[model samples]
Target chain A: MIRVLEQIGRVFLRLFEETGLWFTMLWRTMAWSVRPPYGVGEWFRQMVRLGVDSIPVVFLTAMFTGMVLALQTFIGFQRVHAESFVGSVVALAMLRELSPVLVGLMVTGRVGSSMAAEIGTMRVTEQIDALEALATDPIQYLFVPRVIAGIVMLPFLVVLGDALGIGGGYLVAVRLMHANPVQYEINTYQFLDMNDVWSGLIKASAFGLILTLTGCVRGYYTTGGAEGVGRSTTAAVVNASLIILLSDFFLTKLLF
Target chain B: MTVATNMEPQSDPNAEPMISLQHIYKSFEGKEVLRDLSIDIARGESVVIVGGSGTGKSVTLKHIIGLLRPDSGHVMIEGRDITEMRPVELNRFRQHFGMAFQEGALFDSMSVFENIAFPLRRHTKMTEEAIAARVEECLEQVHLHGVDGKRPSELSGGMRRRVGFARAISLKPEILLFDEPTTGLDPVISDVVADLIVEMDRTLNTTTVTITHDMKVAFKIADRVAMLFQGHIVEDGTPAEFQRSENPIVQQFIEGRAEGPLTDGTNE
Candidate 1:
């Protein structure tokens, strides 16, 4: 029992040390990212890779979510003689919460994990060291581009997710639910204000920052080669998703 | 005081050293890897650091390039201290050197041309045409002219090594550091890499510090050889001097003996 306790204490110490090292590296990377010699081209390429390439998945997920939300909202409001408010509720919910959170989760699974694996591989292979030897700052050349691209492009994806989701609600409510199309459209536009869209965009921006920072931080500290890269990738996605979800709640409370 | 210090025999007045280390000490987890190690390589000289595994050979190279800091020492390049340089200053200092990593480290996402052209595109304001021309020249130097369009995974180990060499020399650095240039290669390929190292030094007049355990490759190209053992240089001399050295560590390593100090596991 004493040995077990001692082992646990050792593991805690190791975690503390690793966290300190990771924070130091992240600070260095963030400090260097804003300086000159920007890889503008790489940033654009990453924007296309992260944002444009992820549209299909975001659209599919949002459409289904919107359809199901409309169905559930209509059923719940029917007993209250307020089924007319179903379209408004579904649209507002999808725009303010579902779109940002869903897109954030999707990107965490796709781009965040890949970034960790790629950077981890580079670290283990000494490519990052090679860049340093050649006088090329890896943070400026690599991390800044991806981070800026993520921040710039994620808002657009969230907007797209919002639009597709609302359209899916429109499809289900008008064609299937036999609702008055004019009333449904009017209710959506009236209830969903600019604040709803802005709030979703805010969430998207925060999620993007959290996702990229966590991914790059995990990857930058990865060691030991293939196994290490694999572990970092998994850790990046899980940690990024958790942070985004936790922060989303805090930000929503503060902003709303 | 200054004049007296300059007059000391420890300072070479005639030939300025291209790279120098002074009282370099580095330790990891309380285990010393380098213990007050100091050495100098003259301009345009090729010095090979010969040591068995874990003799701080690679650590020494990393220190020279400022990848790792000495616990308490100074690393001087072209007579300037780089031990405590800031990021921008370090990058500027590093621009003067190029390193070929042991694994060749080709970016899988990029084609060979892109990988070779990476440094040029990153550092220089060169036009695409000029970058292309430079990439072609580098590829030609490594006898990899037509393979630029291929991905790294499509290439063989030797081809990848050559590509790595091409990328290393792309920026026209004055000093080159090679970490195990001939490691994990067939004998023929090792000979090819060794010849390329020699040819590049002759053509570019570049100062080179190569760390290797392959004595055959080392003897082929090193103008001077330094044998590191137990965190210190046990022998420093010409290849011939090293071959004839009576130092048991150097003799045991060069002869590849399991009975020697390297495999005894007593040093740790």
Candidate 2:
């Protein structure tokens, strides 16, 4: 029992240490993101990679999620003969929760993992050190642009994903479920407002910060070798995902 | 203490060294790597640090550039202790240095011309025309001709290292560091790198600090040699003095024999 308690204590201690290091990276990224010799070109490049390149995957995931939700709602509501509520349910679920959360997870998998791997490879290969030796701030030159890109692009991606999702629901409901197209559009519009979409965009912005910061922290501290790069990349994906889920709860409570 | 004190006088013969590592000690994950290493390099001198594969040869060079801060010691460069510097200050301070890595840590994402042009693009306010001329000159000096737009992945190993050297010296720094510069190169290429080192020292008058296990590279480039054993410098002298020394460890290392003091723990 004593040994088990000691192991738990060590785990908590490690968590605190890791949190402190992560916060330090955030502070540095914030400080350098505003400093002189700004990385305008790098920021735009990351915007294209993190935001523009992710459109297809986020769109597909949102579309399928909306279709499934619509079908599921119609099936359940049919028992009470309340099929008219399906459109409202689909729109409310999408704008308030599904689009932000699903798109966040997708971006975490795609951009976050890739960020960790690229930076980790650079670390192990001494490219990071070489950058430092050449008098360039690695945090400014490498990290700030990525974090900024994620923060700015996630909302835009969420907005696009939300549109695709609602459209998918419309297509499924009117064509397949034989619902009144006018009634479906009216219900979705009346039940969903701009506030729901705004809350989701806010959540997406937070998730963007989480994914990029976790990736950069993991990659920056990576040591050992190729094996170490592999470890950090895995850790980045896992930690970013867990943090996004945990924060989603609090963000939902606060936003609602 | 003395190195920090002699900061003012520019032309004095008794001025402090250009680089000094005093009483450095470092460890990684409870494994002691360096335990009280110290060395000094005067202006215009080429110093080579030689040791076995893992005796902290590269670690010492890293400390000099502030890449890895010593657990406890003074890494003095240009009469200032670098351990006290902020990251921003350190980046500015590193402008005085040019380091060539073992495997030529060129940016694999970029082409050779862009890789060599990185420092100028990042740290300097030079025009595109000036940057181009400078990069072209550096490529010619490193003897890599007409391979400008090719990616780092497209080059051979020797060609890649030469490009790395070209990149390192893009700004024509005051100090040059070579971390196992000839580790995987063929003998002819190694000789070419060695000649470049000599030419840099003679013509550019840059103070050089190189770490290598290759005694031939050491003897060819070093005006003085420092032998690191375990974690400390056991011998410091001219290459000729090193050749005449009777220290069994130095003898084993220079002679490439595995039967002497250096091979003590191998069979134990």
Candidate 3:
């Protein structure tokens, strides 16, 4: 019993130290990120890639999700006289929950994983160190552009997701669920307030920053060889996904 | 060594030594690598430190260029202690030095032209046209004319080493460090790199520090040679002096002896 307890204590201590180092690095990276000598071209390029290029996939996901939600709600509301409220329900849910969560997940897989792998390769190849040797700060060259691109673009992508999802919900409710199109549109626009969109957008922005930062951090600290880089890439995806899920719950609670 | 010490000229009247390492000590984990290692490189002097693997040869180069910090010593560049430099000061100090890694650590994502132009784009205020001209001149210096659009992976080993040399001297840094410039190359390619080192040293008068296990390269380019053993410089002299050394470690190493002080011949 004593040995087990001692082992548990050691594990906890190790965890604490690891977490402390991670936070310290995160804070230092953030501090360095805001300072001058920004890479405008790289930031612009990443913004287009992360934001503009991702819009179509986000739109498709949101539209199908909204259609399904309206379908499900219609079946349940059929027995009661609550059919009129279906539009409101789907719109509110899509805007407040699904849009942010789905977009976050998609971007995590696409942009987050790529950032990790690219930076990990650079780290292993000594390109990052070479950048430092050339008097170009690696954080400014590498981290800030990705972080800025994520934060600036994710909110817009969330907005696109929210709009398309609500549109799909409208199409399903009015056409398939046998509701009046005008009335359904009115209900969705009226019931889904600005606060719903704003909260989801805020959460998306935070999620974007979190995922990119964690991915880059993991890749930057990777060691060993090819195996090391592979392990780091895997760890980056897993940890970014976990942080997104955990932070989503907290942000949802805090905002609501 | 005493004779070589007497031949050591006074410090340059117009400028200080390009780089100096004083009592630099480094250790990884519990193993000490460099112990009380001191090297003074005058302006335009080409110094080479020769040793077997794990004798802190590369670590010494890294210390001089401010890549790795020494545990209990100072790395002085142009009479300034770079170990205590702030981030900005260190970046400025870095601009004065260039390195060609053993494996030719060129940026894989960049084309040859871009890799050579990288430091100029990052550190200098030169215009794009001038940068291009400089890049061309540097490539020509390494005899790598054309092939600027090719990536590092597309290049052969000798080509990559020449590209590494081109990139190192692109900005014409005052001090250049080459970590095993001739490792794993054919005799002809090795001679090419050694000649470039000598030619660059002569043309640009750049103070050069080369770390190598290749005795031929050391004898060719080095004005002074230092042999590292057991974490300190056990021998320091000219190439001729090094060839005629009486120290068993130096003699054993030069003779490629697996016995004597190097191995103690005990593993059998």
Candidate 4:
């Protein structure tokens, strides 16, 4: 009983410390966001890297997901002779949850992991220290560009994902399932409110913030060596992924 | 060291140190790295701190640059106590310093040219043409030619350090800190880097505080030598004085002796 209590206490202590570092870094990054020498060039470069590069994967995931979701909806609805509702279910689900959540997870793995590895490697090789020595705030120079890019670009990616996903549902509904095209369009439009799409976009932005911070925090404090960077990268992806999933629950509850 | 009449340059009370560390005490986890450590580096000076591995030589340079804060002490850079400054505030102070790390620490993401131009690009409003000209000039000074497009990973250890030196001198900082700049290089390459240090010191007139285990590097580059032992500076003097010093810890370290205070069980 004592040992278990000690373990629980240690975990809580670590969580608090991690939370403190996260908030402190977030605050500094936000403060630095408004500071002079705003790195507009760096931000655009990162947008191209993080957002532009991520579009294809996010697009593919959403498209395939929509197809699968539509197929599943058709299977269940066909049995009940309620096939008219399939388009409504697929559109509502994609707009309200699937597109944003899936895109968040995919970006967390792709961009978040790479950010961790890059920054963690920088830490191990003293490149971050070199930045410090060069009189450039790493938070302002490095984190600002990345975090801002994440927050700004994630919604854009999600909107694209949502479009591709709905289109995929349309393709499957009309072409594969042979649903009436006009009826399917009407049901999809009738079921999805602007709030559903808006809520998902907001959740996407929140997830983006979480993913970017996870990479920065893990890399910022990375020690040991190459092995340490590896560990931090893994932790970055895992933490970002966990944050995305957990926060999705809260966001869905609040937004809905 | 002659106990009766030593000619080593003692810290002149009247001379103003461009950088000073007074009673610095630092520890990592539970291990003490620096305790009651004090040193004064004068303006336009080149002081090479030599020590065995893990003796806080590099830590001293970091403290001066405000990269590491002492647990309790004063780290004054240019008459200002840097230890009291926040990390963000330290950037203003660090502008006065240019440092070259052991592995060069060049950003792997950028080309050699961009790596050298990083400080200039960030800190100055110089146009692209000017940045290009400055980068070429810095590269030429360090004797690296036409290798600007290459990544740090593509360069040899010597080439990387040359790039590191080029980057460090890009800002023409008042103080230059080379942390074991010759550690992983061949002897010939080490001499090349050492010569660059001398040339930089002469041309830029920058105060240099370097940490190294290489006596040859120390002898070639430093106007004065300070030996750190077990977190304290045990001996400090000129090249000739360092060569003639009778201190056992110094002797053991310089001579590579397997027995003495360094190798003695008491320290362990």
Query: Residue B137, candidate 3: how far off, in angstroms?
Result: 1.5
Give a tens-digit lDDT track for model 3, residues A46-76: 8998889898789889999999999999889
DockQ values of all predictions: 0.75, 0.89, 0.56, 0.85
Q: Stretches of candidate 4 above 4 Å error?
A: B1-13, B266-268
Tens-digit lDDT track of model 1 for A20-110: 8656766776787778787778888989988999999898989999999888888788889897898888888987899999999999898
Minimal lDDT window, size 10, model 4 chain A: A185-194
Put down candidate 4 lDDT per residue, B3-62, tens digits, no spaces.
111122235656667888888889999999998888778889898999988889989888
Q: Mind giving the per-residue lDDT tens digits that candidate 1 earns over B122-216?
A: 78999999999999999888887689899999998888888998898999999988999989999999999999999988988899999999999
Query: In angstroms, how far off is B155's CA in candidate 2?
Result: 1.3
- For model 1, which pairs clash? none
lDDT of 4 by residue, A1-256 (tens): 9999999999999999988988999999999999988979999998898899998899899999999989989988999999899888888888889988899889988998889889999988899999999999889988999999889999999999888888899899899999999999898888677899899899889988999888988988899999999999999999889889998999999998
Residue B230 of model 1 has an lDDT of 76
Top candidate by DockQ: 2
Measured against the true chain A, the candidates' chain A TM-scores are 0.91, 0.98, 0.92, 0.97
Better of 1 and 3 by DockQ: 1
Candidate 3 wrongly placed segments (more than 4 Å): A1-3, A76-81, B1-16, B264-268
From the highest DockQ down, the ranking of the candidates is 2, 4, 1, 3
Screening candidate 3 with a backbone cut-off below 3 angstroms (N, C-alpha, C), the clashing residue pairs are: none
lDDT of each: 0.86, 0.89, 0.84, 0.88
Can you give the TM-score per candidate against the true fold? 0.93, 0.96, 0.91, 0.96
- On lDDT, the leading prediction is 2
